[model samples]
Target: MKVIIAIDSFKGSISSSEGGAAIAEGIKRVYPDAETVVLPLADGGEGTVEALVSGSSGQLRTASVTGPLGEPVDAIYGIMGDGETAVIEVAAACGLPLVSPERRNPTLTTTRGVGELILDAMERGCRSFVIGLGGSATNDAGIGMLQALGYRFVDDSGHEVGEGGGALARIAQIDASGTRPELTSCTFRVACDVDNPLYGPDGAAYIFAPQKGADAAMVEALDQGLRQYARAAEAHLGHDIAGIPGAGAAGGLGAALVGFLRAELLSGAELVLDSLGIEAQLADAQFVITGEGRLDGQTSRGKAPLGVARLASRHGLPVIALAGSVGSEASALNSQGVSALFPILSGPMTLEAAMDPKATAAHLQGTAEQLFRLIQATAGASS
Candidate 1:
């Protein structure tokens, strides 16, 4: 049998390649002569840089940049084998995890580091980019990133406004005269999964700010500031992007990418899968195996496993998924192309123990072995 496997990282434990390798070994134990094609997969969040970098034989580069709270942070990005495309995850510089729980205020955070990283990559001769936008710790409508890129957001007195979402409403002017001229020659592809508007009840401030540490009063204030920022950009930049799908992603960073950088926003998982050329891998495969750290209701909403399953299904392949744990809502995956779900845990164990790299690899291998035993028995019965 020719089996195709594409598994995402188990985050904090095994990486995508390690997990797929373990499962591939397990399959070998069952059918020693079987052909197994293993591929890396990710939903385009924390592991995006590692996934794309490793898969495409890219080199990683690190740079010091302003963090969410204005502190200097060392962020990592990748240059693909082509040496012209840079892959970046915005969260590496301004993600929620970088802030302490008590200090996790979106109003005070900034995405300046994202721009710094981009500028550094450009200086390195990378003109093509794939930026992953999620897990941000700001509600600033991307003014901070824009500032780093040479745009000026000034108050009525012509003084530049401060950083963070709190400074949005104080802006009265946006000057693009100083924008890096090199930007005109660059191309950006934004990996964004959310389609929220810039500001409103269902927009970034209301739906996502809460997780970024916005209280009711802060959410209201941030929402208003986002509106002001959008208005200023429309008036001064001549591009109106407040209502564009995904404009609210990463606290309106999507708006900056689209309105100013002319980026094409795409589904994060779809972007990763397409980058990996998954369709071609499925062409001659008889069965596909995919998995991630957790499988839940969110899986159907463009997560990596679902991305793999959907594509495999279209090619008349049955997809089986494995996870470290399965949520109560994981059953929803059945309707979205996953034929079955398998949890790799052998039995009860502590969270930390279950997350051990060696333990996870062993469990993945053992679970695959048992699962394929059933398949082997069924195939024999049919014969």
Candidate 2:
């Protein structure tokens, strides 16, 4: 039997690669001769960089770039096995992780560091790029990033707007004469999975600012600042990216990149699936196993496990999933092609205790073993 094991990260515990490894180990326990293939998955969020690097057979390249607050930070990107394409997760530079809890402030944060990374990779000869946009600590609508790329935002006084969102409110004019020339030769795909617009009730500031350490007043201020930035972008770019779906992603970084960098926006899960060549793999697999930190209503809408199951279903393969916790409704996954669902827990345990790396791994191994053994029995009976 051929078994394909694909799992997302357990979140704050084991990585997606580790989770896949454990599932494979369990499959081996029940069918020693079973052929197992491991493909770790991510939904273009926090673990996106590692997942792409691990599953793409990509080489990790590290560079020094500006952090969320202008500090020096080491960021990593991926050059896939083909060696011609590069994958960059913006969070590596502008991520919330780069700022401490006490220091988190969307008004003061910037995505300039992310632009620095993109420029560095382009200079190194990467022509095709996949930029993962998530986990940002900034709400400057990617102006900081564009500034780093040489776009000049000038105030009414003719002085350039300073770094951070606060300065965006002062912008009176914009110029791209100094923008990076290399950008014209590069093709960029922005991996964004959310549908939030740039400035509204469900948009960047109103929805995400508080999480980035913004109080109610700060959220209001950021929202207003973003509205001004969007108008300026429309006036300068001749398009309103702020109204585009997923433009609010990463605190409006998506809109910024779209307006200034001319990037194509795509769903992150779809992008990862295409990059990993999942469509080709499902054709030969007997059974497919996939999972993530949680499986719920959101899983129905292009989440990793859902993407895996959809592909498996296309090939008439049964798809089983595991999760750290299962919430919302199970029926949401039924129509999406999940044949079965497993929570990686033997029994009752605290959230932290249940998510223990070793313990979760053991549970995943055991569950896969049992699941395959049952499949073997069913096949035997049908025979």
How many clashes does the backbone of model 1 have?
A: 0
* Clash counts for all predictions: 0, 0
Residue clash pairs of candidate 2: none
lDDT of 2 by residue, 1-383 (tens): 78888788888889999989999998898889888889878877767767777887878899999888889999988887677678888889988888999999888898888888888888878888888988888888888888888998888888998888677788888899998888888888888988899998999999888888899988888888888888888899887888899899998988987877778898788787788887887778899999887888878877888888888889999899998888868568978889989787777899889878999888888988898889889989999
Q: What is the lDDT of residue 166 in candidate 2?
A: 74
Give the winner by TM-score: 2
- Give lDDT tens digits, candidate 1, residues 1-383: 98998999998999998999999999989999989988778777778888888877888999999999999999999887789999999999898888998999988899999999999999999999999999999999898899999999999999998999999999999999999999999999989988999999989899999999999999999999999998898998687899999999999899989999999999888898888788997898888999899988888777889999999989989999999999989999898899999899989999999999999999999998888889999999999
Which pairs clash in model 1?
none
Whole-structure CA lDDT of model 1: 0.91
**Residue 365 error for model 2, in Å?**
1.3
